[model samples]
Every structure is written in structure tokens, then in C-alpha cells.
Target: MNFSYSFPALRGIQAGREFYTVMCPLRLIPKIFLFDEEEIPAEHRAQRVMNRSRIPDITNYILENPKDYIFSSLTASVDGEMIFQEHSEELKDIGYLTISLDSKFLINDGQHRRAAIEEALKVFPELGEETISVVFFHDLGLVRSQQMFSDLNRHAVNTTSSIGILYDHRDQLSLITKALISDIPLLNRYTDREKVNLSKNSPKLFALNHIFNTNCRLLGKRKGEIISEQEKEFANQFWVLLCNTITEWQEVLNKKTSPRDLRVNSIVAHGVFLEAIGIIGYYLYFYHPDEWEKYVKKLKHIDWQRDNKEDWQGRAYSHTGRINKNNETVQLTANLIKKKIGLPLTEHEQKIEDKLKEASPLGT
Candidate 1:
């Protein structure tokens, strides 16, 4: 004798195939649905291999925001016979689905959510009562299942980093960056809030994500750290002072120079320079706390022209003169700023500088 599992479901048809939508309790998810765990080759598997590294972060998200976390419906395929009992002739689509206990279930998507839910239930057992919607498709062969996965993800696009920073409410750095742009006149007038990369004629000096990253570096804080009011005020002051001190920044603010000309003529208008400035500001704000303004004013004297190859090549720009924002370049750019301000380089920074000197003895 075999037992059966039944669910109240709504039937639907797509591409001439029938599917059922049902609400499954969180507690029942781990017990019923299955994922391919065998170490099989990629071509033989219907789904991509599970990325274990992503599970903990997702689990923490669910556990941390127990009351307000949201998840989209899970999609799965059933590999056995299913019986649907209609309530009435007119309500045929709204009915109950019953399947044998021996049936195999394969998750077509939302495998990470399933793993996270399983982990969350261990700590918060009461959450087991909550229900999540599941869309069940009849067991097609592995070929069809792979096609379904491909078709589902084909058009999905990841949101840009700038927009992510613009809309985020939880990360303190994001909040601080937004507040800084609104409060600082130069930033308010020149920052691009939506797109990460500025087109040639875009007129904006910096992107929202770039400023957010610079703020993170300046504050010396991690992504989600709780920032104090004093810290927020300090960040505001730092940016305002930077706007007033940097020659090109002030020129743009005064309308004496257009953003396009500055972007084309100077490396300072780029995101790499913004991040390098953040690194410089970090040292000024923390180590030279009492006399940072004096050092910050020195930035105006630095040759910001893109053609100043002696100072900028291999630092702000690649040897080919293209702007580069890799870690080494940002650090090299910060080293130049520290030199201009008469600040001592850290041992790591000195080593990088030493290597550069070995590569280019005449400072080409």
C-alpha cells in the first residue's frame, strides 16, 4: 500500500502544457522537494550545481529579517503520477492535486531559497507555519527541464550597481552617500544617480555607485556597519571641503568650466580619482585629524591634467593612457596624493611604489 500527498492548487496552462500552483508550508519544503546531489557531469544534470558559498548569506538574510523578508515563488517538476480533483464543473481549474509518496521532485529554480528556508526553520521553528507558493510542472525529461531553466533565465537582467545604491535603505554607506549628494551643492549639481558609466557627453562628474564606494573607503567602514551621527556629519564635511579644495571640482561648481572639458582633460574627473581621494581622506581624517584642512588644500596644487604622464601614467591611467580602476591603480593614485600632501606611505604602499620604480627607473 502507498500513501499520497495532496495540496489545494490552482491549475494553469502555458505553451499547451498544464501546471499547478500550490501553497506549501515552509516546514514541508525540505521533506518533499529534492535537488540533484549526485556528482554527475554538467550535461547529465538538469540544474546547475549548488553554490554552497551563497547559502549562508541568504540564510542570514532570512533569519535577520524574519518579519519582512520576501521571496518569489519556487518552480519545480514532479516525476510521477498526479491526480487533480475538481471542486465543480465550473471551477475545474481550482482544485486539489494528489501525488503518490513515491514520486521524485526536482527543483527547477529557487534552490537557494529552499536551502535558506530549511536553515531558518532550525533556529525559528515558529516560521514553519508560514507558506510559500510553489509552481509544479509535470515531469518532463532532462532535456525539457534544461530548456525550461534556460528559458526562465534568458531575459533576466541584473540591476546596475548605481541603481542598487540609489534604492538601498539598509546599508548605512548607501544612506550616507545619498544624504551627502543631497546636502553638498557640488555633488547635488554634478553626480549621476542612476547609471554607473557616464557616456562621453553626459555632463555628470561622478556616478552614484562611485561616490558610495568612496564613502565606504573614507569612513573605513564595512558595507552594513551602523554609523553614528558624528560620522555622518564628518563625511558631509569631508566631501564639502573636497569640493572646495579640488581645482577642477570648484571650477565645475562655479560654472567656469564644463564637466565634459574637465572629464576629457583631467584624470580627477574619473571614479578612480574619487576612490584615490577617499583613501587620502581616510588618512587625513584619522591620522592628521587636527590639521587635515591644511593638507587637503594642497590637492589644488597637484597637476590634474590627463597628459601629466610623469605623475599619472601607471597610477591613474594605464601605460596605454586608458583610465584603470583596478586595486593597484587606485593604490598608486592614492600614493601620489599622499606624496603631494607630505604624508608618509604605508609599508605595503611603499613596496608597490618600489616595484613601479624598478620597472620604470626614469619615472617614464
Candidate 2:
């Protein structure tokens, strides 16, 4: 490889700063070894590696301006000796990319660069033809690699967007949302406001958003602290309950003798309805999703307390709330509550029982 002769050390250069000395003007002349993909195992390669649809701008920037790149000076040593070898004919013919067998610190720290190179090389086969200079440290341990990866990616601007998170898990989230919306007839003619509202107002969405955000936060606290099996189970339970509750509420609204008021409704009334349905829905979605579907249908047959004009008097207010569970609206009828959210509840009982049969044995 025709390595650049003048290797310069770039420190934090200020506007008025004069030119300074290079860290290794004592150059370890560049050379090449036979390209060995097996030198670094594939599993140890990188994390979250995937086929990116587009080349990130930063990768292009690095490729175009390789000299601007800086490396940790000590990364050149391998087993207490420098491993900077001379360039072979094959390495010289294509000197565009470099490997860092010397510094696990650099590899861990430069994951974005490494990931970008890996992805970019896939589409641009010519990248494989190029052999760029890499520094490898032979003795860097796992703990050090972990620390390096953490430090490298932990820049000040490390925030991911809500849409980014959504897109990241789109496959799972989309499937679930599609299934729920499909099953709920009321949501068939769904509006964006209603969808956003559903995402915001529905108990299932609320619990789901909480679970997702909490899990993300936990992982953010430490590199490997992802959601545990038990927490995942709880979240699944929460999802089931929330979806069922929304469906049931829709059914109840369909039976109203008066106008519906999801917004102007009392927080206590909404919470009672939401919590009660969520508990029941969670069980049913798993144990008897189909039976639960039938049970939801039967809700339209009964008259709930809110369906009566006398019971709903002075029930609503200007603002719906998050707390204040004491505000009285109206007691859901014993018969309807029993039929909808409560028991003898063969239909409801059957829903969960049937679901249990279909459910997998839970755990890690």
C-alpha cells in the first residue's frame, strides 16, 4: 500500500493554535499481511449489524478523508511488540479499508466506523479491494472492550427518537396493532386523531407505551440490562388487558342511551372502567382470544348504568383526568359489570381457560 508518509497527530486544535508536533513522526512504515477474514471471528465482529439500506453520510466522510481520522497511539502494540507490518502486493493493490487487530479498544470504540465499513463494503465490492491501515492490540480483554464500546458510543448527543424506536421494532408493533385494529370493528373506520388518541388514551396503548419506554430506560442504564422474562410476561398480560378493555368500551359506547364523552368523562369513571377491563382483557387475550371475542359481542345485549339517563346525570365534567379516582360518575350495573368485566361469567371464564390451552409454557 502506498501509505501516506507524513503521519500527523491531531489534538483539539483551536482557532488561533499554531501547528504542533506529530505523535509518531517516528513512523512504523506500513506493510500488509494476507487478508484473513478468520483473524477476527464473525461472532465477535460487531453488534446489531444489519444490512442498511443507505450508506450513512459519516461513512462517506471517513472514506473520502481517511487522513482526518485519528487513532489511539498505543493501539499499534500487539503482545508488547508493534504489529505494524509492511504492505504486501495484494494489500497495496486495494488500500482503501484497514483492520484494527491491534486495538480491540479501537474496534470497540469505532463500532460505528466498523459497522459502516462492513455494510458499505457489501454493496461496494471495490472496498474489499482496498487495504487501509488498522492498529490492533492483542491483549485487550473483554472488560476493556466493553468499556471502550460504552465510552465510544456515549457521546453527548446519544438520544434516539420516538419514531426511530417505533421503526426499530416496527415488525412486532405493526403486527400487534394490525391484529387489534382488525378484530375491533369500531376501529375499522379509524381516524388519525382517533388513532393518535387510541395510542394516547386507550389503556392498552398507555400500558404498552409505559412498558416499552421503561424497558428502553432499563437498557439505557447499562449496556446489557434488557427486559427479563418475567417483565416480558407482565407486559404481554398488560397488552391483552388493554386491547380487550378498548374493545369492550367500544361495545359499551355502542349501547349508550345518551351521547358518549371519552374526553369530558370523569377520570375516576374512566380509570375504573379501564383498570377493570384491562384485568379481564389481559387474561382473555391469551387464554381465550376467540371466546373473549364472543364475550365482547355480548356486551351490546345488556344495559349498563351509563346507558340510563338518570344514572349519568352530572357524571361528566370539562376535563378528563389522570388521577382523582374519587369523582363519582355512575356505578356500572351489577348485571352488566358481571357480564362485561365480572363473573358466573362462564363466557368470561371460558375465555381465559381456552386461552390457557393455547398459550405456550412461559419462561426464559
Candidate 3:
């Protein structure tokens, strides 16, 4: 006289332990699987506490792209017995898994996805018909469940920013970056598309993420903003003009100098300077749009050596000579670039420059 829930599942054995993979309806997710409430302490739970802040972004993703969204299988541990009934001897592992209604179902991983699913179902109940896979393992105890959680996440590493930008088709900036890399021969030849930090011996001059970020600044586009065709053309023209104007960039392009040596000796070869250039480009685009080329060509006259302490030390690098990539340093570098191009700084830029002068009266 016991009630039970049954699911079509595929049985499998892993490290001498039996497990089952089952397709679960989204509607059943909220009713059957259980997660520890926020009140539970670390020692008593198998998984980390649900990150409430992350739920909305994920739920919005599901809601925004219902037809194309994908979610990985959820891993859970059942704290009670499961009965697997096979079709026949020929297909012993393929059948139905039945569990009593009284058993406890605990989520060991992917608690966020489960929470998002519940929220999405509330908004669009038709999505409840969709199925998400769940891998169930027998819960040995708190220790075993904790070990499973640890093992599951120990090898998980997030993708590098460059690779993320390279693969992302949804972000307009990512798409424009990829297009820039393709259209500009200098970038196509020397841009590192998959790594964030280039090694000492790496042949590439700039990271893909750096290009994306600098372009975002140059166009003054916020994240997820729609980019116009004219803006895309302007970005292409600006970068191409920049590559031709910068003496060292042209040197590296023509194989007259090595990227390693340029990176070692020049601040202009770094991402900070790339971003500084973008900041300057923003001002030029707005204030001197018709004659920005005349100002940009003046870049060839400026000293970009890392050892040029009077110009670069406090702006592009710390007093200790280490390159700094903070916003303040980027702004400081852009202020110097604006002066070199004979462009006037905005009130905000002038204030930042004034503070630096007050802090270092001797212009150290």
C-alpha cells in the first residue's frame, strides 16, 4: 500500500556503484527533487548554498531564448532505495526506475539550473513539457555526498576570456571583434584569439579579448547594445588607420621587430595602452570626427618606451615598473595620449589629471 513514482531510465555502473540516467519533466523538478534551504549549515549539506543572485540571470536566459537554450544534466543523490525493472535479459540496463514517494531526493550539483527551471516554469508553464536529464546516485551518507560534490567541481575550470569572446556569437561586441580580426590583415596575422595572457615567447601581439574590450570603449557601446553597420565600418577604418600610424605596430607587422621585444620594451604594445588608445578614439570620434586621422597620425611622433618614466611611469605602470591595468592608470594613459594628439581633455579627464598633478607636484 505504498505510492511510487516511476521514470524511464538507463542503468549504468561506475566504479562499482550503480547509477541511473533518467529524463525528468520540468514540472516534476519542483515537486520531486529537494535542495537544502539557506538555513542549512555547510557540514550538514552535500552541496553549496544556492546563490540567489545568479538565479535571475539564468532564468532570464531560459525565458529569453526558450527554443535554443540548453542545460547540462543535473546530478543528484537519492537517500532511499530505487527499484530498476529491466525489459528483458537482452536489455538489462534499459528499463524503468521506481522509487517510493517517501524517499528524500537531494541535489548534489546544478542547484542553480533547477531553481531557474522552476522560475521559468512559473512564467511559461508550457515549458513544463520539456525534459532535462538527471543522473541519480545512491546517497551513502553525508561524507560520501560531500566527497561527490568536491570531486564533481575539482576539475571544472572556466573558459578563458579570449576563448569566450571568440566563441560567443550572441554578443555584438564579440561578433564585431571576430569580424575585425578577419578584416584587418595585421590583426588576422598577429592576434591571439584563444588566450588571455600571451607568454613571453608568444608570437601574437594582442589578445582577442583585449581587442573586444578596446572596441567596446572606442565605439562607446554598452554591453548588449545594438551596433549599426556604419559604426562597424568606422571601427574597421579606425583600427586599420591605427595599425598604419603606430610605428612599432607597423614594424611588427612587417617583421622588422619581434612582438616579444616590443611587448617587453613598449607600453603601447600592452592591453592597457590599447584600451587607452580606444579611450582617446572615443574623444576624437566625438570632437574631431572629420579630422581624427590628422590627430591619430601624430602617434608616430610620441615616445612609447616603457622606460620613458616622465610620460609612462605613473600613467601606464606603477612606480615599481610593473604594468598597471586599473581604470585610473588607463585614464591617466589616455590623458597623456590626448595631449600628444593635441586634443583637449574633457572636464572629467582634466579633473583626474589635476589630481595626479596634486599628488605628485614634481610630475614624478
Candidate 4:
């Protein structure tokens, strides 16, 4: 076999059933091995975690039929003395599944498999399995080994983050486009810098994606096509309007005596932004463009209860906060749209505004 690894260790230790040890300067090495399929040993096979069964029927399987699992010679090696000191000492007499190997001591593909085998052997003292079968890489380093581990485990039968999941399956243009479009509302509420943060790490992005993709169990429709043309158009317009709205919101947000009242951290804007998109696109689509623009600009410039970061936090958790004089001005704009376009508002929202108007005459 043409091995990419150099095993000078072979000269130091006899390559037989006994373990070998050698020493060399640190570098990189890669190698490959072929494994044979055979009947799993009774003791080893019983050790497999197949469902909830606690005891592996190892002795029975080994006694009844031992010819099914085949064992192969390990074609692994490491920098002789260094590996003996740093890595292989753990393997002293401990038998393991030698599946394959790659650069810098990369375990080819059997981490879980090896783990299960070890777990089984640990519980069963009769197996006498000491050394695990592992291939060796002469060339790869620690960083590359970590990256390889990530690649293998990412797809190895495990649950992962939605963003991580999204990134992996994002080769589909439709999915990527949907993710970008759906995250706008969240990106808007936080400052522009906040948007970047959301794009990279925020759950808001995932939440919006869930809502947009209708991935929600209660609200989403899974049977329909990925994204309908009407939905696409709605998404496009919604993004455009939200971007403008956020820009306007910031202009007002900065002018407040204390912008903390606005509760920028809350998801209120997500709901409001969603509602506004529906209202503007579906109901008030034909409104006078310039007049609408002027009103929006004016709304953006208005100072209100939303000026407080605490208020923004309250809004995040569904608290509308007190409608002081400053907030009433901003509330009026929202109320006017609700009345003029006949946009839908939940009873709770109407009550919130009513209370605000009562508390803050200036806003009314």
C-alpha cells in the first residue's frame, strides 16, 4: 500500500500482535486502512447499544455462531516515542475498533462506534479486549484534526443548531433567500450593528425563520410548496418597508432623553413590522405614496414611550408600558393607520392603546 504516512516507529517496535513504540520530530502524516466485515463477537456484539436492552448477549452469540464478524489487522502507527508518551499510553492493553486513520491522528470515522464498543467492554471483564484497532496518520496537526472531527460529527446522526443546520443545507438558493428575507424584522429593531449580530448569532433570526418557513407546529403549513409566488412578493415588499421603517425608527430612537425606554430588545417590532407589512401591502396598497411617506417619516421622528430602552424590554415581553405624553405621539400614528386602513388589531392591542391614550394625553 502507498501510505502517505512514514512509520519510522516500525523499525523500533516489532509490527506484530504486540504494540509498537517509536519517537520522531513532530511533522504530519496520513494513511488509510481497509476493514473486513464479519460476525461481531458474541461478547462484543452483545455490548452494542441497540435500543434499551441493558445486557449484551455476548457469550451466547460467541458460542452459537462466531464466524459472522471478522477481525482485521490494524494498519496504524504514530511518531514512535512521542505518540507512546502523549497518545497511545491510554491504549495500554485496551482493545478498540481500528476502522481507519487520516492526518494528525484523525480517527477515520468510528468515534461513536469505538465509544459504544469501549462502553460494552468496560462493563464486561471477560472480553479481555485491551488495544483498540486504530489507523495512524503521520502528517495532520491538532487544528486540522479538530476540523475533521467537526465535519464527521456534524452529519453523524445528531441534532444541531438550526443555524448550523441551515448553513449545512443552505446550498439550496430558495432556503438561503428565505432565511435572509425572514430575518429582517429582527435585524431592524436592534441598531444596524445589532442587525449584523443577529445575522451571525441571534435566536431572533431562527425564530423569524421558523415563523416565515411556517416551521412552527401551530402556525406553519408544511404541505404547501416551499414558498409561493404570493408569499415571495409579500416577503420582498415586507423587507423593503421594514428596512425603511427601521431607519425611521432609529432617527426617533436617538433623539429621546433616554432611548432605553423604547425596549429595542423586545420583539414588539417583529409583530408590528409583520402587521405593517400586511396592512400596507394587502389593505392600504393604493394609498397616496407621498402622503404615506410623509406620515411614516413623521411617525419615525415622533418621541414616545418607545424612547426608553426599558420600554423596549417591556415590549419584548408583551408589556406596552405607560403611554406618557411622549409615547402618545407615536401611538397616534399607529392608531391612525389601524383606523384608516381598517387593519386588524387584537383586542389586547386596542386595550393597550386605549390605556396609553388615557395615561398620556400628549400622545393622544
- Candidate lDDT (C-alpha), each: 0.89, 0.36, 0.90, 0.36
Using TM-score, give the best candidate's number: 1
Candidate 3, residue 129: CA error in Å?
1.1
Q: Point out the higher-scoring one by lDDT: 3 or 4.
A: 3
Candidate 2 lDDT over 211-311, as tens digits, reads 23323322222222344554444444444443444433554446541113432342212334443344444445456645665554454444334334332
Off by over 4 Å in 3: 361-364
After superposing candidate 2 on the true structure, give the runs of residues whose Cα lies further than 4 Å from its correct spot. 1-104, 107-173, 182-261, 264-279, 285-340, 344-364
Instruction: Give lDDT tens digits, candidate 3, residues 1-364.
Output: 1788899999999999999999999999988888877788889878898889999989988998899899999999998879999978999999999987888998888899999999999999999999999999998998999999999999999999898888888878889999989988889999999998888789999999889889988999965789998788878889989988999988998999999999999997788999999998888888888998998899999999988988998889989988899789999999998988788888999999989988995864
lDDT of 1 at 258: 90
lDDT of 2 at 224: 25
User: Candidate 1 clashing pairs?
Assistant: none
lDDT: worst 10-residue window of model 1: 355-364
- Candidate 4 residue-wise lDDT, 1-364, digit = tens: 1324333333122334244332221111111222211255533221222332422333333333333432222333232222332225664433332212332232434433333333444454334333333444442344444454456456755333334334443223335344554465443344222121233233232233333332211112232235455455544544455456654344434553222333343233333433333334432334433344443334343233344443332222233543222233333334544544445555655786677657654665
Query: How close to the true structure is residue 65 of candidate 1, measured as C-alpha lDDT?
Result: 83
The local distance difference test score of model 2 is 0.36
**Which candidate leads in lDDT?**
3
